[model samples]
Target: MNIIALKSVDLAIIALYFVAVLAIGFYLKRFATSGQDFFLAGREMTAWVAGLSFLSANLGSLELLGWAGSAYQYGILAAHWYWIGAIPAMVFLGIVMMPFYYISKTHSVPGYLQLRFGNGASGLSAITFAVMTILMSGVNMYAMAVVMKVMLGWNIHFSIWVSSLTVGIYVAAGGLYSAIFNEVLQFFLIWFGALLIPVFGLIETGGWSGMVARIQSNFPGQDFTHLWSTLGNAQDNPMGMHWTGIVFGLGAVLSMGYWTTDFLVVQRVLSAKDIRSAKMAPIIGSFFKMAVPLIVILPGVLGLAVLPEKLVPESALQAGQHSYNEVLPLMLARYMGPGLLGLGVTALVAGFMAGMAGNVSAFATVWTYDIYRPYIRRQAADAHYVSMGRWCTVIGLFISIATAYVAMGFASIMDYVQALFSFFIAPLFGTVLLGMLWKRATGPGGFWGLLAGVGSSVAMFFWVKLNPGALAIIALSDHAKPLAEDMYRALWSCLINVIVTVVVSLATQPKPLSELKGLVMGVTDIPKEQNVPLLHKPAFWAAVSIAILAILQWIFW
Candidate 1:
C-alpha cells in the first residue's frame, strides 16, 4: 500500500511519458485541418499504425485490472475470455466485415446503417452506440483513476479530471488523428510495461520452472500451470485450474463482442485509407493480443508464487475488493527499481490516456456525423461541422468523467460496465449482422429486432437481479451461467427481432427493387477506379500466420 515511498525515479519517468503524449497530440494537429482529417485521420493510416491504434484503443486500464482480478480469483481459466472471445471475433471482422464496410465508405457504423437500413434504423443504432460508448468511456476512466490513485497516491477525482482534461484537449484539437498517433506510442508502452511485470515476476520467483514448481508446491493441482486452460473458468474452478476456463473466460464472450462488433475497434478499420489497410489492422493487433496474457495474466500467477500471504490481504480475495486491480502496480512496486518503475508507471498512464483518446474520438464521430449532422441541421460548412465536432469531444469527456465518479460506487467497474453493454450490444449486433447479410431484412425488421433484443436482454437482466437463486437452477440446466443467461436472452430477442423485421418488411411492402439496389450492392459513390487489388497475397498469408501463432500460443503456452 505504501508503494509511493519506494519509487521516486519511476514516478519521474511516468511524468515524462505524460508530457510526451501531450506533445504527440500537439504535433498531430497539422494533419487535422479538416473535419474528415480530424475525425478519421484523413483516411491515411498505414496498416501498422491502424493496427496498433485499434489494439491500444481497445486495451485500457480495465483490461489490465480485469485480467489481474480474474486471474487472481479464477486461475488459468480466465484466459479464454480473450482467446475465444476476442481473437477469432477480430479475425472474422477483418476478413468478413471490413471489405464491405470499406466499400461503403461510411465514416461510422451508424452512418453505414443509415445507408443500409434507413433513417429510423440508423438514428436508433447511432443513439445506442453513443450511449454505450459513453458508458464504456466512463468505465475505462474509473479504472484509470483507480490505478493513478494507487500508484501516485493522487486524489481519485482529481486524477480522473486531469486524465480526462489531458485527453480531451488533444482530441478536441486534432480529433482521431491525435488519438491514433498517441495510440501508436501508448500501445508500445503498454506492451512493454505489461511485459516487464511478468519478466520481473519470473526473475523474482526464480524462473519459469521455479515459478511452476512454487505454484505446484503452494497451490497443488491448479490449472494456472498452463495458459490455454485458464480461459473461462478463472472465477469458479474446483480443480487446480483448467485451460478451458481460459478459453471461455478470455476467449469466447469478451473477444467475440469486442473484436467483432464494438465501434471503438471497428472505427479504426473504417477509417483506413484502403481495404488492404483495414484487413491488416485487426490482423496485426491480433499478435499483440496473443502476447498480452504472457505479460498481464502470468503476473497474477506469479503473484500467487511470490507475494507473501500478508501482501495479498484477505479483503483482496473478493473479485473486486482490495484493488486486485492494482496487481500490476503492486508487482511493479515490489520488483521494479526506481527509474524503471517510473517508466512502468508512465506506460500505465499512457495506456489509460490512449483509451480515453480513442473513446473521445469515437464519441465525437458518432455525435457529429450520426446525430448532430442529421437532426441539428441538414446543411453546414465543413469548417462549422468540424468545430462542432470538437465541442462534442469536450462534452463526451465531461460526461465520461462524471460517469467515472458515479461508477466509483460500484464494487466491480468492469463487470458493471460489461453487463450494461451486454443489454444493448447483443441486440445491436443482431440487427447489424442481419442487416448486412440478409437482403430481406427490412428497416422495420432491423428496428424491431433491436427493440426486441434489448427488451429481452433487459428483462433477463432484471430477472437475474430479482431472483439470484434461480440463476443456479438455470446454470445446472444450462452449460454456462453467465453466457447461458446472455445467450438465452440475446438469441431469443434476436430471433423475435429478426422475425418481426423480416415479416413486417416483407408483409408491409418491400421498397422498390431500384431503391434497394444501393443497399444490397453495398456500394458508395466513392471512386472504385483506383481500387487496389485485395491483398490476398503473401503478406496477407503472413498476417494470417501471425494470427495462427497467437492461437497456438493460447493452445500450447
Candidate 2:
C-alpha cells in the first residue's frame, strides 16, 4: 500500500482541496454574527447545499471502509441495508416527521424534546446524542487514520491528530456555514471516487457479464447476480440474505434514527430557509442514497471477483475473519492506476473531513448552547458565545483525536463503534419518537422513559458483555459471539424501551390538552405560504416513480 510516491497532480489536487475548504470557512465568517447564525447558518441554507451536506455528513469514512467490508462478507444483503434501512426511513422523516419538526421552530431535536416532553427529557437526549457523537466521531477518525496509515505509511496517531486539526480549523472558523459548503465539495469528490472503483473493477474483470462468468467458474451455483445472497454457507446452499434484517435492522432502525433524530442531520434541515426546504432536504438526499450501493457497496462485490487470493494478508485469514473493511483501500492500491488511486484516496479523505467537520460543528452547538449557556453564569454576548464555540470545537477535536487512538486498540473498529451507538441511540430514538407522535405521551412518561430506556440498554450491554451467551437459547452457537449478542441485546432493549414508554404514557394521565395543543395542532405563527414550495403533483409523482423503480431494480436485477 505504498502511496508515498503520489503524483504531483494528485498531491496538488489534495492540497488545493484543503486550501479551498479553509478558504470557504473564512469566507463564511461574515455570517457568524449571533449564536444562532454560528450554529444554524442563520437558517439560510439552500436546498441543494442542505441536501449535499446531509448526504456527505452521513457518508463518513467509516461508511466507505466499513460498508465495503460488509459487502465482501454478506454479498447483496449489504445493499439491502440502504434500500430498506435508509430510504423508507428518510421518506417517512421527510413527509411525516419533518413537517412537525419544522413547525416546532426549535433549533435542536433535543430542544424539541424539551417542548414535547420536559427539561429532563431534553437533558437526557442531549447527553445521549453528545456521547454518541463523541464515540462515533472517534471511530470515524480512527477509520480515516487507518486509511492514511495504510495508503501513506504514516504513523496512526500522527494521522489521527493531523486529520483532527485539519477539520477543526475550518469548522471552528466557519461553523455550520463552513461544514455545509465543504460538504458540497466533498460530496462530489466522494461520489466520483466511489463510482470509479466498481467501473474500474468491472473493466479489469472484462465486463459485468464476464465478472459473473468468472464468479461462476470459481464458485459455481453462487447467486452473485442477486443482491441478497450469503458469501459462505454450511449446507452447500446460499444462506438466506436476511432481507428482513437489512430492511428492519439496518434500514428502518439505523437510517430512520439518523434521518429523524440525529442532530447532525436535523441541524442541516433546521438550517433550511423554511419548512419546504426542510422537507426537500431529505428528499433530495434520498436521490443520492439511491446511488450509494453503486458507489460504495458494489465495489466490494467487484473486489470479491477481481482481488487475487493472496491480496488479503494471511494474518487476516488465520483470524477467521473474511471481512476486512480495508478491502476497498487494498483494491485501490492494487488495481486502480496511480492517478485514479490518488483521486479515490482523496475522496476518502474528503468524506472523512466532512464527517469530522459536521461533528465539530454539532459539538460546538451543544457545548455553547445546551451545556454552556444554560449552566454558566454571566450570559455571554453573541461575540463571546461564538468565541466559546470555537474553543469548544478545538477541545472536541482534541478529545476525538485521543479517542481515535484508543479505538485503534479494538479488534474491529466499525463493530465496536456501531455497537456503542446502538446502546445510546436505540433507547433515545424510541423515547423521542414516542414523545413526538403520541399525544398521550406525558412529560413524566418521557422522563421516566428516557431513564428506563438508557438504563435497560446499558444493563443489557453489560449483561451480554459479562455472560456472552446468557441470551442465547443454545450454548456457544455462532449467534453467541460478542458482537451478535450485543446487537441482539440492544435491539431487544430498544423494543422494551418503546413498549415501556407507550404503556406508561397510556396508563398514566395524558398531558393537559391545553399544554399539548400547540404541537398537536401543528400551528406556527409563521404563515404557511412563507415556507418553501411544496412538491408539485408532477414532481411528487416523479419522485414516487423513482422510488418504486429503485425497489424494482433491486428486486429484479
Candidate 3:
C-alpha cells in the first residue's frame, strides 16, 4: 500500500523523536508553577534560543512543504515570501516594536491593545487571534497528513489524530516552555534532515545552472528562475503578479502584518532574557531565514526539472494524479533512502507537531489571559489560570482537528493560510501600527477601525467566493491569481483600517499624554542600552541582516 517504504530504522528514528519530545515535556512540568513561568518560559531565553525558536515557530506550514509547493507552482517568485516579505518586517519588529512590547510588560498583543486602546479593540483582536491560531494549526496538521498520505500511503485520519495528540500532551504538560524547546529542536532537524533533496537534485542536474537549463528545456518560454526580472507585469511571470503587488502588497502589508503584529511569533521574542535579547532575536532569525529558500525553493523548481509526470491540482488528485502539495514528499522519496529517509520523515513530522504546538500554546495563552481572565472569571488564582491554560491546550487541539477537515476542501494549504492572514493579520497590523506611532489614536477609533477592516476583508472574501468576477475588481487585475488576490486584499484592508483609524481618532478625544508613557512612541522615553558594546547592539545586527537580504535578491535576480 505504501508508495515509498520505510525500514525499521526509519520507524525507530521516528519513535525516538516522539519519546524525546514527551520526555522534554514531563521534564519541564515542574517549572509551570506560576502563570508567567507557564506562559512566558520564565523570561530567561537567550538571543540565540529565542531567535531559532522564533523562526522555527513559523517554520511549520509557512516554511517547509507549503512554500516548496508554491515554488513548484509559481517558480522563483515564491522567494518573495521568504526575502522581502519576511526579513524587513522582522528587523522592524526587533528595532522598533519589541521595545514597546518589552517595556510595557504586556502578557499578549491584545493585552497591549487594551492598555493603549480599550476593552473593545483588545477583546476583538484577542478573539480574532485565537481563531486564526486554530485555523493555522489546522493548516499545518492537514499539510503533514497530505505529505504522509502521499509518500507512505498512511491514512489521513491516523496521521492527524496521532500528531495532534502528541502535540497536545506535550504542550499541556509544559505549556510554552515545552513548545519553545521543541521548536528549537525542530529547527536543526528540519534543515539537516531535509537538505538532502536539494543536494541530491543539484548533483543529479550538475548544479544550479544545470538545474536552470533543465527547467528551461522542460518548460520552454516560461520564466521560473528569476526573482524580480519577470515581475514587471502579471503575464510576465508564472505567479500572474506585478512588481507593485510583490513590493507594496506582500513586502509591505502582508509581511509586516504577520511578522510585527502576529503574537504567535512575537511571543517567542518576548521570552528573551532582557530588552537586548528581545531586540536581537528577530535579527538573528533574519540571518538564517535568508537560507531557507535553498531547501524549500530549490527542491520545488527541481521538481519541475526532474519529476517523471506532470503534477495535477488538488481536484484531480483523487483521480490518481500528483498534486503540487505533494512535491516535497515526492522529491523526498526520489532522493532519500533507508536511514536518511527516516530522518527526513521524522523531520517533517516534528515540524508539523511543533507548528501545532506553537499555535495551540499561543491560542491557549490568548484565550485564558485575553478572553477568559478579562471576561469570564476575573478573580481566578494563579494556579487556576495555569490549569485553564492546560485544559485549553486540549480544547484547541480538538478545534484544530475539526479545522483540518475544513482544510481538506482547499487545494493548497498555503492559499488557505494566506487567506486567513488577510482576514485578521492585515487589519490587526493597521490597528497596532497606528496605536504605536500616533499618540492621538483613541479607543473608539481603534475599535471601530479594526471592526470595519475585518468586515471588509470577510465581505470581499465571500464576494469572491460567491462571484469569482469580484476578484478582478478587488485585485484590480483580470490576470490576477489567488496569490495576487491575497496580496492586494491585505493591502486594501490595511489601508482601510488605517484610514478609518485616522478619521475616527481626529474626531474623538485622545488618551491623555501622561497616560501614554511607555505605551506610545512620542510620549515614551526608551531606555538606552547602556554599556553594551557595538558588537552587542541590535541595530548593528539588523543592518547586517538587511544587507544580506539585499545581496540575496541581487544574486538571485
Alpha-carbon RMSD to native, per candidate: 4.0, 3.7, 1.1
lDDT tens readout by residue for model 1, 1-557: 44565356666676677677678778877778898898888999888888888888877777777676556654554555555556676776776667667776778878877877778878887887888788878878888777876777778888888888889888887789888888888877877666778887887778978987887787776655655433344233432323432343234433454576667888887778777778778877777776677867787678778776423422344543445566767777777777777767777778778878888898888889999999997799998888888898999988887777666655455556656666766566666776666667777777776777677767767777798765544233323435334434444455556666777767655555555443444432323424445464424644565567676665556
Error of 1 at 135 (Å): 1.6
Q: State each model's CA lDDT, in order.
A: 0.69, 0.70, 0.91
List residue ranges in candidate 1 displaced over 4 A: 6-8, 206-209, 220-222, 226-254, 310-321, 473-506, 512-557
lDDT of 2 by residue, 1-557 (tens): 44345777777777777788878888887777788788998888877788778878888887788777666654555565566556676777666677667777777878788788877778777877777777778878888876876677768777777768878888887888888888889888887776777877888889877877776776566664565434233222232323343444455555566667888877887888877677778878877876788877778777778766522321254432333667778777765566776788889989888888888888788767766766673466788988998898899888777677666555555557656756766677777777666778877778777678778767766665677565452112334333334445445656777777777777778877667644643332333443434453223733683567477556634
How far does residue 231 in candidate 3 sit from its true spot (Å)? 1.1
Number of colliding residue pairs in each model: 51, 3, 0
Candidate 1, residue 381: CA error in Å? 1.3
Quick one: best TM-score, which candidate? 3
Residue-by-residue lDDT tens digits, candidate 3, 1-557: 45599999999999999999999999999987889988998898999999999999999855788888889989988989999999999999999999999999988899999999999999999999999999998888889888888788889999999889989999999998999999999999999898989999999999989989988998899989999988887888887898888899899999999999899999999999998899999999998888898889889999999998778667667566888888888899899989999999999999999999999999999999999999999998999999999999999999989888777787677888999999999999999989999999999999999998999998888999899888788887778888888998999999999999999999999999998998989888887877889899999899999999989889989
Cand. 2 TM to true fold: 0.89
Scored against the true structure, residue 553 in model 1 reaches a CA lDDT of: 62
Model 2 misplaced stretches (Cα beyond 4 Å): 1-4, 216-225, 228-244, 310-323, 409-411, 471-487, 507-509, 521-546, 549-557
**Candidate 3 wrongly placed segments (more than 4 Å):** none
Worst 10 residues of 1 by lDDT: 238-247
RMSD of 2: 3.7
